[model samples]
Target: MHILMVSHFFESHLGGIERVAGHLSRQMIAQGAELTWAASAQDRAPVDIPALALPCVNPTEKLTGLPMPIPGPGGMAALWRAVGRCDAVVVHDALYVTSILALVMARMRGRRVVLIQHIAGIPFASSVMRWVMGLANAMVTRPMLWAADRLVFISDTVRRDLIGDPARRDYALLFNGVDGEVFTHIGPAAQRLPEGKRRVLFVGRFVEKKGLSILRAAAAMRPDISFLLAGAGPIRPASWGLANVHDLGPQKPAQLAALYRSADCLLLPSVGEGYPLVIQEAMACGLPVICGAPTDRADPEAGQFLRGVPVDLSDPDGSAARVVAMLDAPCLTLPERAQMAAWAAGRYSWAAMARAIMGLMAG
Candidate 1:
């Protein structure tokens, strides 16, 4: 089936939703589906897929803060045109204005519109920002939901949140998959730590929602373990004086692979998430994960690689203790690690994610 995937950001800016969209688009193309992607010109060109760039709706007005547009003219028209040419349109991240426009236009065209929601909660912002966001969502979300032929959520928790009521059954859960081969090549986890120090890796944006402060406090509490923070954002510099932590900035896929290879475990204390692609990536590298429990029901298949640890954002000391426990636990053996890696390879493959999305499209 011909599909048009609309996202506000793409490969140039590496985020979870952007990565999911890029991965799905590539897989769909491999399966002989015609795919066209639309995103803001502010984003860099996507990997392997040709994309139509729309003008940045809300241009990044500040250098130090987040770069996002408010919604512009050309972007709306490009979205409409992209969706018009395809048999169906999949809108990733419903909160984005571009996705909302595509949803409305696709419905108007009588084409199937699938909304992919990545997060379960809205950002906790200032009263004014919260009000604006709530108003914007109210204006756009209902129409998008009505227009969508199907709603695909990355996790069961996200699906439930989007539907709001247990009685409402309008969405399906599609778990994010990983590229097994890329991670399988990470070789065995290094037996010896560099300089005999336990290396803990944190991958994701430096945002409050990611529980960066919790991670910082945790690192400070455990001066023995060395920490490597990957990815760029507002929170990176804020983590400044902790001698044990090293902010490697953002790394390319290869660099990330190396980081995973050298690390003992992946540390993610996110306050919100649908499904973190980094978890799969870490598992692919044969590294066990210690993450905040997803509010969604656990996936039975994923139990082996993940240890659901409790994180109290308000209590940094308690959160640090959790991280310390993870760090002190017995490391997974080579054989055990291999099993986790294989599980990730088998369960989270791009092909599998694409097939799940295709099933939604067909339904």
Candidate 2:
């Protein structure tokens, strides 16, 4: 089957959805399915695929994050040509203009379009900002979702919150997957840590919704612990102003994998997320998590191997206290951690995800 993958950003972008789109595209090709990709021409990711780079302007300063004008006049013919040739068009997010355009074009060509929802709405710091997003989604994206041939929700939270009763068919809960084998431990020799100092790693862009304020407060409250923050975006970790926190900047997949294997634990207190690929990578690396954002996929059976800890997102001080308490609490032994990694490797492999998606795409 021929599948066309459409997204605003691809491998060059450092978001969960972008990374998954890259994975899904590669897997589709590996599984003998013909694949084509469409994204902002400005995205200069080194991906080996038949990708149509459409013209777009990234309005980073805009309140609406998904405001990239997809398939400008010069790119319309290219996008439509791709749609006409594909059996199915798999668009990443329902709300992005790029995705919306792809959906419309695919529908025009009598092609099936699968809309994979990363999250229902964008994450915001203020109630006002979130309110704007809600209004736009209700008016714009909901109609497209209903029109889609297949609806794939990344997390149960999104499904329950956004879609109370889906008047759609062929819907599935598709959790993000990663290559666990790449993130697994090497022999007995592990990275040695300083005496009595456990490494707590936080991975994600330094954005408002990533719970940066909470993480900063938590890092300050617990001076006894060492925290390493990974990822780079518009925000910077230096603004947090804590000595215990060190910025690792953006990481390549291999570097991130090594860090996961070496770290004592993963701690992300983000306000919005479906099932992060980072959490799955941490589980595959046999590292336990202390995430404030919990979903159904946060469970061990769901391949995240989540060791959830409750913390008030509104109160960073409370989140810090919870971090300290979780550290003080008992953790899994080496053998158990190994078992967790094994289970995650089996359940959340990219190969498995590709197979499931193929089944969904098959009309």
Candidate 3:
């Protein structure tokens, strides 16, 4: 089958959406499907899957955090030309302009459309903006849900929270994966930290909904633990004014794997996520994860993982106390770490996820 994947941005960017989309596309190609990617003109795919770069610009950090494609008349014309020849269209997002255009073009061409959503809804800073985005999601999502032949959600939590049930008869909760071979253990993790300090790693964009602000207070509360933030975005982690916090900027997979191996644990207090690849990656690297509970947030699948604690970020001091207590607790032993990695390896992987998505395609 010929699959055209519509992504807002591919390479030259570091985010869950880009990485998950790229990994799945490669797996699709490996599964005997001819996959072509349509993304921002500046973006490129790491693998052999061909990329069609459309005109894009650096706008404010809204929506996806990455730069968005300027799906102008020319861009839409380009997408139409590309879609005219594809067998099936898999759009990674339902909110982006490129995705909207891809869905419309696919419908017009009588092609099957599969819409993949990594998030339940758009998170905003203000209540007014949140309400506006909620309204937009409702208005836009309805048609796409009706038009698409099938829908793919990254996590069961998101599927339940966003649409209530899978009664639509054409949806699946295919979780993302991490490269266990790469995120392998590298000796003792305590050795990578300061003299007597435990290392706590946070890997995600420094955005509002990510809940990095709470990490600042937690770091100050527990100066014995070394906090390393491994991402870049609108808000710099070091700027939060925690002397114990170290900014590692953005790291490549190999470097990230080493960090995971050496770090005592992974901490991500983010909300509004459909399961994060970083969580899977940290687990694969054999690091226990301490993340936000997805009770109200998307990512309930995360609640199943071990070697971690789930804390509600609503109460700043309470959340900090959880981290403080966890820090004082013993880190995961080698056997426990191996068990954690194996659990993630056995259940989630790119090949498995791609096959599940492909299963949704009409034969």
Candidate 4:
């Protein structure tokens, strides 16, 4: 089957949705399916796959020492032309004007369109921006839902969020998968820590939704453990005053692999998520993950794989205690780690996700 994959950003933007799109497209091509990518013009070149670039409607502009909004022109004609020749169109992220245009064009052409709802609900944005997004969802995204042949959500929580209307059918719960082969190799825990120090890794954006403040508070609570914060965001500082907390900035996949191998455990105190890829990556590397339970939060699918595991985020004291326990406990043996890696490999494979999408297209 011929497929067209559409996303807002590509080529190492390093977001979960971007990574999923890249992984899906590559695996689909390997499985003997023709795939093409459509993204913004400002995107970096040599995507290592066939792709089409369109001018970025929203350009970042500085005005009076403040950043200006980037407006994207809806490329309906171009998107229609691209989807016309393909059997299915898979939209990775559905917030942008380009994606909306593609959704409209796909409905017009009677082609199968699959919308991947990456984020369940908006959080912590400006009131104006939140209202604008809400309005857009009501006007563009709601109608597009009616046009979709099927809806693909990374978690059952997301599926529940989209299942308000009984008439809306054809939805599936597919959790995000990781590349088990890359993280299966287990590295020995180094004994070079200063006296009695533990290494903890936190990977994600430095945003409100990610609960960076809670992480910082937890770090402050645990003075014996050393924290390494990866990834870039507007809210992150070049450095922090906390001696135990080290801001390593953003690291590539290779560097991250080394970090995961050396680290004792992964800490994710996020307030919102849609099947976070980092959790699976950590699990594949044989690292135990301590995350916030989805109770009171919007996304329930996060706790699906975390069954029977402790997921408490009630307060900083409780959160830090869990992290410390996981770090201080006996590490998983290599064989045991391999078993966890195998589970991740089998559960979240890109091939399986692609097959699920193919099933949607077939219907």
TM-score-better candidate, 1 vs 3: 3
lDDT at 53, model 3: 78
lDDT of 3 by residue, 230-308 (tens): 9887777767677789998988888888888888778887666777888888877778877765622334544555433
- Using TM-score as the yardstick, the better of models 2 and 4 is 2
Ranking by lDDT: 2, 3, 1, 4
Give lDDT: candidate 2, residue 254: 79
TM-score of each: 0.87, 0.90, 0.89, 0.80
Q: What are the RMSD figures for all models against the true structure?
A: 3.1, 2.7, 3.0, 4.6
Question: Which residue pairs overlap in candidate 3's backbone?
Answer: none
Kindly report which residue pairs in candidate 4 clash with one another.
Answer: 57-71, 57-72, 58-70, 58-71, 177-348
Q: What tens-digit string does per-residue lDDT give for candidate 1 at 316-343?
A: 6787788688778887888988888877
Question: Which residue pairs clash within candidate 1?
Answer: 57-71, 57-72, 58-69, 58-70, 177-348, 178-348
For model 3, the stretches where C-alpha displacement exceeds 4 angstroms are 44-47, 62-68, 122-125, 166-169, 186-191, 295-333
Model 4 vs. true fold: TM: 0.80
lDDT of 4 at 152: 81
Two-way TM-score contest, 2 vs 3, winner: 2
| lDDT tens per residue, model 4, 1-363 | 899998876656556777888888888898888988887666573357788676664443221111112224544456667889898899865656667777778888888889887665543335654565568667766666666778887865455555563425777767766776565545543333564577888887665556566677777777788887888766653454788887878777767767777776777766446667887787777766666545222334334334222333335466556645655656667776667766766667788988888778778
Best by TM-score: 2
Per-model CA lDDT versus the true structure: 0.74, 0.76, 0.75, 0.67
Off by over 4 Å in 4: 57-77, 125-142, 164-168, 185-196, 295-339
Q: lDDT (0-100) at residue 285 of candidate 3?
A: 74
